[model samples]
Target: MAIIIAGWIDLDVEDVTDIIASAKAHIDGAYTENGCIHYIWTKDVFVPGRIHVYEEWSETADLQYHFDNHWYKDMGGHLRQFPRKGSQIRKFRVDLIEPVYDPSGTPRADFFTAK
Candidate 1:
């Protein structure tokens, strides 16, 4: 099963641009790793200091490999350079994935669960 990781990082800086710039290399490097389906860091438009992160891996082993990578090791130091209010990252094991939109541009009700 694939693993999906997602969360937001609240930065202390006035803007997330510089932080993104500094982390660009690390983010780009992730794409070359095995089982990296997607890895992204995006700034929240409504909140200036917030950064949203999303990642997908083929399996738990792949995610573990990411944790053991040098870039992941260096990320902590790089992030600490800029003060941050806080951050959260969570992982979910996906048993199934379905498209939300059908070919005809209609919503697929079966793809989502009701609250």
Candidate 2:
């Protein structure tokens, strides 16, 4: 099943401009991984020193492989340079997948593919 790794990190580095700049290469490298569907790290508009992270992998095993990959390791080390108050990252196992809109473009809350 596909999985999502999502959360936020609060840091002591008031401005994360340099951190984000340095992470671009590593972030791009992660996208080259076969299992990566989407990966991103962006700043929270209303919060200073906060970076939001989101990553989706084809499967749990793929995410495990990423943990040992150079891209992940490099990003970890790069971010380690800055002081952080805490982080709340978590891995989510997906149960079902569906689009928010149907053919008519109306919003939907029920799972069309599972039933």
Encode model 1's per-residue lDDT on 1-115: one tens digit a residue: 9999999999887789878888988988888889999988898988879989899999999899999997777776788887889889899999878778866788987755432
lDDT of 2 by residue, 46-108 (tens): 888999999999997788889989999999999999999889999999988888998789898
- State how far residue 67 of model 1 sits from its true place (Å): 0.2
Estimated TM-score for each candidate? 0.89, 0.92
- Give the residue spans of candidate 2 off by over 4 A: none
Q: Rate the local accuracy (lDDT) of all candidates.
A: 0.87, 0.91
lDDT against true structure, model 1: 0.87
lDDT for 2 (candidate 2) = 92
